[model samples]
Target: MELFFKYLQYEKRFSPHTITSYQTDLHQFQEYLQEVYQLEDLKVADHAIIRSWVVTLVQKELDSRTIHRKIASLRSYYRFLVQRGLLETNPTLRIKAPKLAKKLPAFIPEDAFTQLLDQSEFTTDFKGQRERLILELLYGTGMRLAELTTLQLEDINLAASTLKVLGKGNKERILPLNASLINALSHYLQLRSATFPNNNSSFLFVTDKEAPLYPKYVYRVVKKYISTVSTANKNSPHVLRHSFATHLLNRGADLGAIKDLLGHASLAATQVYTHNSIEKLKAIFEKAHPKA
Candidate 1:
C-alpha cells in the first residue's frame, strides 16, 4: 500500500486531490476487509473474499460508477503487489466490475449559453471578470474545471491562441482559444498583475488577495451563471463542458478530434457526446415530421 502511494506520488505524478481520493477509497476497502473477513494483510486476500466485498457494495446500493472505481483501486493495488513479488498472484484478476449504463450528459442550448454569458458580463469588478472568463473557457475550450483552476500564467499563450492544459493522469494537451476569449484572458491578466504587482502566484485566476482560486469557488461561479440562463435539470461546469463537446459534434467535428481536444484517453469516452447529438436530431425529426 505504501509503495502504491509512493508510485502515485512520484511515478504516476498524480495531483494531491487525486492521490487523496485513491487513499480514501483504498482505506475504505481495507476497513471492510478487516471487519468482515478478519484479514489484516492484503497478500492473504483471495478472490472469493474480494467478490464478497463487491457483493456487499452492491447490496448497499452504491452506483455502478462508484463500485467500478473501488474495484479499479483494488485491481491496481493487487497488480502493484504482484509485480513487486509481495504476492504470488493477483486475486482481482478474474473479478468483474459491474456493468455501468452510460447516461447522456445534459447541456444547455445555444441561446441559453449566450444568455449565461450576457448575464455574467453585468459586473465590472475583478470577480465578475474572473467569472465571465471561467464560463468562456469552459464553453470555449471544453476544459475541466480542475484544469482551469490549476492553469498558470505560462500555460496560456495569447499570441498562439492556445492554452497548455494539464489534464487527468498529469497528461498535457493543447486547447485552442478564439480571438474573443484570447482578448478576455489578456485583459484579465493585465488587471490581475496590476492588482498584485508583487504577487508571485503562478495561477492564471486568483482572488482579490492574489491567492489561487479554489475548486469550490469555480463551481459556485459556474452554478451562479448557469442558474441565470438555464432552466435545465443540471447546471454545473461539467454541463458546460458537455455543451461544448455536443455543440462541436453537432457541427460535424470528428469524434477523434473531439477526443483529443477533451483529453479523453479513449474514443469510447468521447462517444458520449455523440449520444447527446443523436437525441437532439431525434427531437428535431419528431418536430418536423409531416405525417403522424
Candidate 2:
C-alpha cells in the first residue's frame, strides 16, 4: 500500500487532491472488508467480495459518480498489487461502474456576465479589484478552480496577451486573452502592487494580507458575484469555465481549439459543450422558424 502510494505520488504525478481521494476510498474499502466479512486482509478477496461492496454502496444511496470513482481507485490499486506480485488476480476486473445520467455543465448566460462586468460598479480598492479579477480570470481563461487558485505571477504574460496554465497531470497549456481580460488584469495588478509592495508570495491572486488564495475563498467570491447576475443552482468557479466554453462554441469556436484552451486531454471532454451549443441553436430555430 505504501509502495503503491509512492508510485502514485512520484511516478504517476497525480495531484495531492487525487492522492487524498485514492487514500480515502481505499481506506473505506479496507474498513468495509474488516467490518462486514471479518476479513483481515483484502489481498485474498475475490470479485464476488468486491461486487458485494458495490451493492452495499448502492444500498447506501451514494452517488453513482462517487461510487464509480471509488471503483476506479480500487481497480488501480489492484493493478499495482498484481504487478508487484502481491495478488494473483484483480478482484475489480469483473466489476462494472453503474451508468451515470448525463447532466450538462451549468453556466451563466452571456447577458448575465456582461451585466456583471459592465453594469456592475466594482470599487477601486484592493479587495474589490482582486475579486473582480477573479471573476474575469475564471470566465476569461476557462481554467479550472484549482488552476486559478494556484496561478502564479510568472504564469501570465500581459505583453503577449496569454496565460500559462498548469492543467491536470501537470500538463502546461497556453491560453489567449482578450482585451477586456487584459484590462481587468492590468487594473488588478496595479491594486495588488499598491497593497502589497513588499510581498514575498509569487501568486498572482492573493488575499488582503498578501497570502495565497484558497479554494473556499475563491468559491465564496464566485458565489457572491454570480448570485447577483444568475439564479443557477450551482454558483461555483467552474460555472464561469463552462460559460467561457459555451459562449465560445456559440460564437463558432472549433471544438479542438476549445479543447486545447480548456486543457482537456480528449475531444470527448470538450464535446459536452457542443450539446449546449446545439440546444442554443434549437432555441433560436424554434423562435425564428415561420413554417410552424
Candidate 3:
C-alpha cells in the first residue's frame, strides 16, 4: 500500500492532502474486509465484495458525497493495480458510486471582505503581519490552503508582481498579483525577515518558532478573521476561494481566465461558480425590470 501511495506522490504528482485521503479510504476498506470477510488481500477483491462495502457504507447513513469519495478512492487504487498487471480486472469497474446533489459554492460578499481587510485593525508586529498575509494570500490569489502552506519565498516575484502557485497534482501556475496584494506581500516579507533573521526556513509563511505553517493553524486564522465580518455558516478557507472566483465573475472576468487562475484541470470544475453569478443576475432582473 505504501508503494502504491508513493507512486501517486512521485509519478502522479498528487498533493499531500489527496494522498492522505486515498490512504484513509483504502485503510478503511481493508479493515472492513478483515472484520467481515476474514480477507487480507485487497488485490483479490471481486466486484461482489466491493459492492457489499458500498452497501455497508449506505446502511451506515454516511453522506452520499462521503460514500462517493470512498468509492472513487477504490476505483483509482484498483485501476492502478490493473495498469501494473497485478490485478486481472478492476473490481470497482462494476460498482456504482452514490448519486450526489449539486451544491452551490458558499462565499462571503465582497463588501464583507472589504470591511475585514480595510476596516479591521492588527497590531504592528510579526503575528499581526502573518495573520493578514494568510487572509490576503487565500483570498487574493485564491490558492488552496495546502498550496499556500507549501509556498517558498522564491515562488513570489515581487518585482514582477506575479505569484507562482503549486496547485493540486503538483501543477504550477502563475497568478498576477494586484497592487494591494503586492503591497501586503511586501510588508509581510519585510516583517518576516526582520523577526526571523536567523531562521533557516525558506517557506513564505511560518510559525513563531520559525517552523513551516501547518494547515490547521492556517484554517484557524482564516476562520477567526472571516467570523469578524460574515455570519455565514460555512466560513472555511474554501469560502474565500469561492468568493474570489464568484466576485471575478460578477465583475465580468472570463471563465477560462478564471479557470487558469484557480488552477482547475477542467472548465467544468470552474463552472460551479457560474451558478452563483446566474443567481445574482436573477436578483437584479427581479428588482429592476417592471411589467404590468
Error of 3 at 286 (Å): 6.1
* TM-score, candidate number 3: 0.93
Over 1-292, each residue of candidate 3 has an lDDT whose tens digit, in order, gives 8878999999998899989999999999999999999999999789999999999999999989999999999998998888888888888888988889788999998999999988879768999988988898888988888889999999999999998988887788999999988988899989988998898887999999999999999889888999999988888899889999999999889999999999998999999999999877887788888951
lDDT for predicted candidate 2 compared with the true structure: 0.90
Q: Which pairs of residues collide in candidate 2?
A: none
Could you tally the backbone clashes for each prediction?
0, 0, 0
TM-scores for all predictions: 0.87, 0.90, 0.93
lDDT for position 11 in model 2: 91
Name the best candidate (by lDDT): 3
Name the candidate that leads on TM-score: 3
Put the candidates in lDDT order, highest first. 3, 2, 1
CA lDDT, every prediction? 0.86, 0.90, 0.91
Error of 3 at 62 (Å): 2.6
